[model samples]
Target: MLMTTNEPAPAAVSDGMTEGESGALYRLMTWLSPSFPVGAFSYSSGIEWAVEAGDITDAASLRGWLAAMLTDGSGFCDSVLLAQSHRAVSDQDHAALSEVAELAAALAPSRERQLETTTQGRAFIDIARAAWSSPGLDAIIAACGGPIVYPVAVGLVSAAHRIRLAPSLHAFLHAVVSNWISAGSRLIPLGQTDSQRVLADLEPDVTATARRAAAASLDDLGSATFRADLASLRHETQYTRLFRS
Candidate 1:
């Protein structure tokens, strides 16, 4: 399962350009592309259940939920895992990578969220390796078996593609927020213009989340979003549902 990349690294940036500027752009596009096949469209991260609970029924509520999630729940946990995974791969510590992977697997509060992250993670790694052909990625894929957790896969790909940590973290947050917002658009029936406005309002929160993630330590990983977790758990028994989680 050794990952192999045939494409040479992009030519070194010119004197004025920052390191990895081109690689960051390329990686951002890959991660953000709707066609990346991560199956992001299928999971709502429990927003549907929240909406049903009447906890979230408008743009303001959706924004609050997303803010809490980014600061206190899966977003924070995933950021820690992503950082650890990056270090593990950089150090060639396969054991550490596996540990972080397991942590990521356990981080999800519900079955659907667990499945959503891990399934897409495994797919992302497989596809990214095939398309990018990086040996570092190949080694990681081989070490981790076939199914790597999403954050770990993201960290590995970030390293393989030579994308810097800060921008990569921002991209990760944006992707998470975008998925939820897209789900909100359907479940709450927000207008397209409203969706765009909501996204705009979310920028500051997204940037703050990324900054915190960039500075976060493993000690900061605990979550207190009990209501959100309960909703996700209850989603299993939800009689009718639109989103998977």
Candidate 2:
């Protein structure tokens, strides 16, 4: 159960500047919150198949699987795409943005993976534009010429909102990781505390991946998590599926 927090956003501190930062923090929290209308909860990114296959049976195994993802698989790939998209939008380089968008669209290893990302992506754009309309978001949609990939959509809007790439990418990846853990929780029937423990254990991987991605170029995009890919593939045939992927 990935739940949204109701705690108030932090107030501006006396760190030479606090006002400008508060809105960014609040926007990130709201945009990435579990309650955000992205249908993120409906897709397990193949975790259902992994659990069914006994590949993720406990917190330790779940952490290990997700660590690989954050460092070398879809997690890392999405980070790079997001970073590159952010930079592209910030630089106003429509060509680069379009290239990244095309690559992201073609990179999904499975049809369901494609569906998961594009569906959430299109939703993100429609929702964001309605609430936080910006030329940057419109630019990404124009470049994409159709549905946007999830990370690219987030990157475009974050840039449009003038949010820094580092924090935005980190937040996006964290949400992705949390969604996966939530799926694992329900599938493995793991306790809530155990689920949280796995999330805590993956913080290092998340931070390291985010840092690496912030400085990465399009060439850095690639996924090596073969089993994770296979899991999504196998999930297509998983008859008792509780997830779309």
Candidate 3:
């Protein structure tokens, strides 16, 4: 008989400076923590639609779909936005910051996708201000002058706290993956062990994607995750679903 375990792959050691001059690292973790009231659990990013369509029926299929998302779809686009926001914040380039924030919000393919990013983003900013107030949050808010996306808000807060870009991006990407895995576990009804295994298998892909995002610019952004995008659009009309997409 086969057995299962919840053990995860060992994480790579940090680059040491991630701790920052103050409590930057801890706050960064708090902002991205699964418990963060972003309502991330409510949206499946169209994975629900895909699952209902039989595109993700098992662990292997879930893993494959997730891998493609991390590398090319909304995941890649969000990473780029996060990376740009990090740089813009670090430079205090308010114009660039606002531009990217607007672009990120506008690029959402469907109404649900827009709601997913913007609502979570608005909640993130509000909760952060209430509990983790900082000058950085204010700066980003004033600069943005409009709606924020989840990743952009995170980037601004991290930059304000003097957190280094690499680890910030790494943590942000990991949170995105973790949220998906959590959604997959429920939607796919995978065993905890299988979910953990899928996350473990994605370790390298996540790291590489973050690294590439750090070096990428807006011009480098594009998505070939066509099926995923369509699924997100279709989720708008999915007859019965457990997620809001």
Question: Which candidate number maximizes TM-score?
Answer: 2
What tens digits encode model 3's per-residue C-alpha lDDT throughout 1-245?
Answer: 00011233233337533223225557767888899888998999989888889999999999999999999888888999998998898788999999999898899989999999999988988998888777656866889989998989887877766677787888888888888988888987899999999999999988989889989999999999999999999999889988888
- Writing each residue's lDDT as its tens digit, candidate 1 over 97-207 gives 777777677777788878888888988887887777876677776766546788888987886665666777777878888888999899987988888788898899878
Off by over 4 Å in 3: 1-22
How high is the lDDT of residue 173 in model 2? 91
Worst 10 residues of 2 by lDDT: 1-10
Q: What are the RMSD figures for all models against the true structure?
A: 4.3, 5.5, 8.1
Expressed as tens digits, the lDDT of each residue in 1-245 for candidate 2 is 01112334344567644554766778889899899999999999989999999999888999999999889999999999999888888787888888888988999999999999999998988898998776656656797665689999999888777788888988999999999999999998889999999999999999999999988888777888999999999999998989999
TM-score, one value per model: 0.89, 0.92, 0.90
TM-score-superior candidate, 2 or 3: 2
- Regions of candidate 1 where Cα sits further than 4 Å from its true position: 1-20
Lowest-scoring 10 consecutive residues by lDDT in candidate 3?
Answer: 1-10
Task: Arrange candidates by TM-score, descending.
Answer: 2, 3, 1
Question: lDDT values of the candidates?
Answer: 0.78, 0.87, 0.84
